[model samples]
Target chain A: MSFEWPWQYNFPPFFTLQPNVDTRQKQLAAWCSLALSYCRHHKLYTLDVLEAQESPVFNNKKIERKLSMEAIQVVFEELRKKGNLEWLDKNKSRCLVMWRRPEEWGKLIYQWISKNGMVNSVFTLYELINGDDTEGEEFHGLEEWMLLRSLQALQTEGKAEVFSMDDGKGVKFF
Target chain B: MDRFSWSSGLLEINETLVIQQRGVRLYDGDDKAKLDVGAALLSTHRLIWRDVKNHECCLAMPLSQIIYFEEQAAGIGKSAKIIIYLHPTPANKEPGPYQHSKYSYIKLSFKEHGQIEFYRRLTEEMTQKRWESTPVSQPIPTGSATQTGKTRAVGIVGIERKIEERRKETDKNISEAFEDLSKLMVKAKEMVELSRSIANKIKDKQGDITEDETIRFKSYLLSMGIANPVTRETHGSGTHYHLQLAKQLGDMLQAPLEERGGMMALTEVYCLVNRARGMELLSPEDLLNACKMFESLKLPVRMRVFDSGVMVVQLQSHSEEEMIASALDSVTDKGSLTAEEFAKLLGLSVLLSKERLLLAEKMGHLCRDDSVEGLRFYPNLFE
Candidate 1:
């Protein structure tokens, strides 16, 4: 999918992290926004740091400028601080892109369940993620860890209960 | 050679009498009265009487005529006196019809007995010189002849003769010490004044000297080099000398900085200042330290290191915003600027120009475009 990049994306200096403190802050903010929107448009839930180095979002081939790993990590760190990203591993080699926050995703799932009249029904995690019935949904085939976290958020709100099933994990709406 | 070297307009020798004498009265046969209060200088050919009150009252006399030189003994309530006897007319010249029939003498009475010693030294110098050389004509006793012949010569011819005589007398008295080397020394002092006056004249004439002449004059002044260089010996120690060097560098940089539009690379300033200083050169480290001192002193010039690690000296008043605006003005129709083009416009080295462009990019005044042509800068249209 095509994404409209900001005018600054064409600017070579934008690819190089600015050394000045004030300029760096603005650069970080711009990078964070661009990365978030780029991931959202492509529906990419996880971004591999090493892979992003070669990706068009991090490297602008037209300008022949590429952001270093350190620069990418710094931009990701800013997104993490704003609750828009989470490191999947301790080394921060990969990150879970939270285009929508966990709480927002929990509310989305609740609205979907209520619309389909599935309140008080049980659904296995696998069926909820990849079942044919949920094929058209935004959360279908979502990462299991992110799905589990969203369900846990719903459980904290007393809207659902998660329990172990013989086949796999399952969640039941109250 | 004559007893005195006349190559110098006046007699070359100079000797000061040792005794401090004051308030001695000289009487010339009741017609001339003069005070001899200061030390007398004995030169090779003349006895020069210098007055303490007015140094211009320098009277010289030949050594041969002081025949009866004697110091009278002090008496009760009377000061000691020196008696100098001379021929009624100068012994070497024809006696004129109006010459005095009797002998003539000058008697000087001193206030202190110490002066008697000076008289003795004078007598000794006169006797020693008399034995060494033959007599020469005295140019008519100036005091006595002026008094006697004043009424006879009053016409234009006499006035011209007086001027000629005065010119000759002045030429004989005002010794030129180093006639050949003196012109340069005199010109050095006069050149500064002359340049200032010429500058004023140019100002009055309003562009009469032209830009080329002004530039030539500036180069000429720069070539003159520092007259009094501040070395370690001049300023005492290394640190103090460095501080003084820093000050001198700041002063020297003002002109070049103005010429370059308020900025110059550190290397260029180093070369120029060292050239101006001639023998005294500062090391690069010393120059850096000197620049650091400017911060504490609140000097108007400062040292700046760009992110690219290139250093330059610029005036504190120089604004990056203004530099960007000017650089933008020089951008080609393609809306890009290479370091070479920027350097040419800013009158800086390509390296320094690149550094400044990088700084401007950091400041968000411009954005970089790295292409096959090389790293170029364009105005930050994103802003």
Candidate 2:
């Protein structure tokens, strides 16, 4: 629940986006790294800009400096360009933080399924995400869209089958 | 006469000979008693009578004070005489009590038949119109004249002889030269020559003075006079005057620009050009226009306006690459470059230095660090 911020987070100019081109580029890069690291430490998959405005990650209370919404959007845009973030809506009020790429997540899921001997068994998306049997797993309580994308990646590799039932989406591995 | 020569040795600056008649025999009034035989030179400003036997005993009279000039017909026994009546300058107007009466008339007999008529017409032309409207005053006596009678006067006769002798020497020539108001054209040339000689003397004594003092003295001499001023009357049209003035300004800026490392702020250039110009000062707009004219003329100097709106005049040979290299060297040596520090390195004003630093930053030659200590520049390591 606690995240140790980089030393630059306390630097005042770090919160204020630099106006110079080169300085701004470096500042954006720093912001992107800080955002990703902070999100990963808290296991935060969704970042709401309005909510982040009040969070310690975006607002450095010791320095009395906070990134403007526009500055935050610019940093997020850079992250999105690097395939590290996905805008959830047209307004970009929220973004899906890809702490790990879907391909990497798909490989992790395959390892988990093989270790549990569930290679020939079927499981509901709900069980795979929030089931008691999958407790303490990295994919536990993962967002459905991200989980489905990871499963689709696995299906593309011919390692799993995805099906729909009245209960919800299901995945079968062979 | 046919053998007469109006030599430069006899004429002073601004003294143009309007008429010269040789074999002219001057007499005392109409008595036909010949006083002295001399060659007469009529100038726009004065009449010079150089004694045929002794040129040192030459006499000069201002044409403005000439009361009358007449050509008398030849009597059976005498040749025609050209009579000139002169009103001696008033005692108060005269600087001292020298020889020559307060008012006198002299008659000159010429051997040439039409010479008297020619002298009459030339005298009319010289005296009819005043060369200058200002009334002529007697020339001030120099130190030599005043020293002669004052320091050693045993008796009135001795004093009179000394004054006469001094009058025959330098004072007479100088006073005559000064008495003519139109002689300013000649005086200006003399003044330039005199200053040049003084400047040379100062240059000889340069070792005695400090470098700063020497520079100050040289600048004083340089700004003392403008020999050929560009005026509307001299150049004829406004455009020509501006063009000529621009050329003059360009030439004048060369030394100062070199001193300042091939660049100077426009305001500084404006001040320098105006100071050198003295009376004929150009407006800032005129200076800017003149600078703009430099571009088309392919002059060696140029005017540049920085992004921050500061303008400067820099030489065409000035290289931004060289400036950047120097700036980088300074930054490396000093670690960081403030406006003040960069100003010293570039020999420019702080404001201008800051502008230059910003320009370098824009050009990717340097980077800026804006912080609590104010803006400082470093070499663009990012590039």
Candidate 3:
């Protein structure tokens, strides 16, 4: 996308951390919005700090700009402070985006299965991902481990039941 | 020849001509006082013959003008005279009143009356440029590079090799000077680009910026202009002169200083001035001294030391009291102001935020609000 004022993108001060607290706060806010937009649009759940290829926030093509590690940390720290994200690993290299958290994802799955009347039906873990029953749900490309965990959470809440068949991987839902 | 004698000896110069202004002082050997010539039209000083003609033309006297010579029998003015000959001789040599031992005597004492007349004629020709009247600065039209019998300058036979050597030396010096200047110029251009891009970025994100932030941004912005200022290293023996050159650099910072309400820190000036000077940098002491000297002389600018002991160079025309009064009036009419809001009302500079508030408070122009959310500022408590 072309900026109306392309010179704004090329300005090197954009890369520097403003020492003034008020300006830095504003800068941080803008950065947060940019990061959220990227994560949501790309359907990305985790961001690798070391990987420059995947993170869209660092990619400023028109100006050939890239945010510093400190800037990236500041933005993520701000997001974490706001309870909108979490570091999946302690070193903070990998961050799990919680703008839409696992609990919310689980809730979405529950709603979809109930609407499709598949809450009482049986299916294998493989079939649930590859199954016709979940035809138009957010569950289609959902990670298998995440889907199991979410399903298990639903079971614990008494919203559904799971029964194992001869195959340990197979399960019947009720 | 008589004209030369009259101009060199009888031309009484005034006092103002000999006094050094803006550059190095080349003093007269005999006169501890200013060499008195005559009053000059350009200034109040004595007009030396050389200075009167803008230093391009000068009169020369023959050695016979020496009415009485001090014989160096044992050691009396002889050593000092010897120094004149040991040093680099003047390229266009002239015989002054005194004869020094080191310089070649040129067989003057042996050649009597007739030789003196010949010497006078030679001096007159060299001084008047009798041969230089020819306008042909181009190649001799001998049709080819290897052609012979081309007319050359007089007395330049064995001196031809010396002329070539001198030409090469001069050419080398000129090219080296230009090369250094060009390098500095290119560096200056790069610095400008760098600073521009930085300032542009800061400008783009101006919305969330606070007054203190704007102040800092301004400082950064000021420094951006001086990407390639001349420094001391670039002009080694001319640091003082270069310092003066840097003051001219401060002229460009005027608009930014004015916008920031008429004062900026020396640290800020230093960064900006050094950057602008390119490779020609003045030391911090030199910069300060230059500023102090400028102030002492009642230049348009002055150095303002705040109550906090922070030094800033600013235009004397800027009035802090007026700014505070105006800021007070605006804030009081509104009844109150947050520090952030107040900064917006007045263009806050890089001076300490607390100090600004403290000053306003002291002036009965502002009051503090330490509330649950955060510390803030409001209109003066008197209202």
Candidate 4:
């Protein structure tokens, strides 16, 4: 019989620390991982520690654990320390998630175009995604920011050209 | 010579006195001094004694010397008393009683005039623990010398027998206390009471105790050690060992942090350490000092301060691999693995693993995909 996993005992604050030094260190690491995982799973681009409820770290029920302001700061601090995340607002309510680093994204785009025999072909932004260009490929759901960064990188390397007209439309070519 | 005096209080030529509670000093034409008055020490007023170059010299007189001044018509600087004595010589060692056994220096005392309530209180405290004066030794009786020698020999034998008895008692007590300690945790109250009674015996017989005896007693009592060790109330030069006690308390909490992958909060550590110490609740200052001492030692673990001024203590070598391995092992039993699926896993919640995964992606250990669902990492296509 498939075991019923139950309601997944979602004590939210377990993801958060107890404002204690040692507990908080453990909590921060745990929360940062949870947050990263959540972001990666849902393809979330930005996270607001304030508004996010499904973020497991914000809920605490099993052992009545809770995250103090300091605990939240520590988790964010951990992310910032690793250079994988950034605060988006002055109040630090939101943070930009860098799922893959900018440089690696550049390298991926370079490799993808060369391998696909699209080096000498021109393609529209929509065609790159919804068109046949990236059908059945990993780049199908690539974020606009990642695509833009990859395109800019290719342009820098003289591997591609980007053109814009009076109507404010854009296209790319190898 | 009586250095300076205003009231009935006497001032010395080269001695420093803190106005525990003030009074006056009177000086005669022959450079004699006396004082009588009242001054409060808690006020903003401070009388710093100094040498000619204005260092910490004993020659500076107490502010009570101002008690010798007459009621002068208000002059600002002149109204205050500033008496300079000859530069005093430094002691062969730091000043303590019995430093100069031979020639006595001028001694100063204050006699209060008005509202000497504070002075009276001070005197009461000083006199509470009065010294018993024993007369200077006369001669030992010569007739009993031979008998006394025999008695002394017998007395030594008796003391040795007593010491043996005490040793067995201490050893038995220690072994019992530790017996309970070895068997998980027992009733803390019982342990404390056991220790307390033993401490009482140690205190009562301290006069007859030798160093070896005391050391043995302490070793046994270590099992029932201080329910409350040195506190701020009982801290002084003699209690540096209290730091070691506090450090041991910190050590007990190590297992809890270690279990959670070498990460813990500073405040939690403080609470756990203090709780383990039982009655030894350390002040915030003591806790901070302990943390700092640990930092200076450059232990394998470290204290961290976040951007939000939140402090935490974590391992310096905290490895993401350990966390990831634990997380992966917990989940690897299931066949399929996806980025979002892994993110939802508790094993992935550890900070080090998240960092490692990011690094692995950067170093070609993994690759990531940004889908409408979210961002996900998988085994690197590059690798």
Taking all chains together, each candidate's TM-score versus the true structure is 0.51, 0.51, 0.32, 0.30
For model 4, the superposed segments whose C-alpha errors exceed 4 Å read: A1-30, A60-66, A156-158, A165-174, B1-383
- Per-residue lDDT tens digits for candidate 2, residues B1-383, read 11111222354444456777777776655454323676776776566567677666555555655677777878887778777776644332222222434337766788655575567666666655544543235222221223323433334765577568767878778878877744754664566667678778877897888998878877876765554667667776566767877787777777788888788889998887765655555688878878877777777888888877888998888887776677677776786789998898777888777876776666666666555567777665543
Real contacts recovered, all predictions: 0.21, 0.00, 0.00, 0.00
Total clashes for model 1: 0
What is the Cα-based TM-score of model 2?
Answer: 0.51
Better of 3 and 4 by DockQ: 4
* Candidate order by decreasing lDDT: 2, 1, 3, 4
lDDT of 4 by residue, A46-120 (tens): 778766643444544453434555656676778888766788888888888766655566667667778877777
Off by over 4 Å in 2: A1-27, A50-69, A87-93, A101-104, A107-120, A126-145, A152-169, B1-214, B220-233, B236-243, B293-298, B328-347, B368-383
Scored by lDDT, the top model is: 2
Question: What is the DockQ of the complex in model 4?
Answer: 0.02
What is the per-residue lDDT of model 3 for residues B187-207, given as tens digits with 9 covering 90 to 100? Answer: 877877777787777778887
Against the native complex, each candidate's DockQ, computed on alpha carbons, is 0.13, 0.03, 0.01, 0.02
Q: Scored by Cα lDDT, where does model 4 land?
A: 0.48
Quantify all predictions' global Cα lDDT against the true fold.
0.70, 0.71, 0.52, 0.48
Query: Model 1: runs farther than 4 Å from truth?
Result: A83-95, A115-118, A126-136, B1-218, B224-251, B279-312, B319-321, B324-341, B361-383
Which tens-of-lDDT digit does each residue in B274-347 have in candidate 4?
55454545676666666655555655556665444556666667664664554445333433234445545544
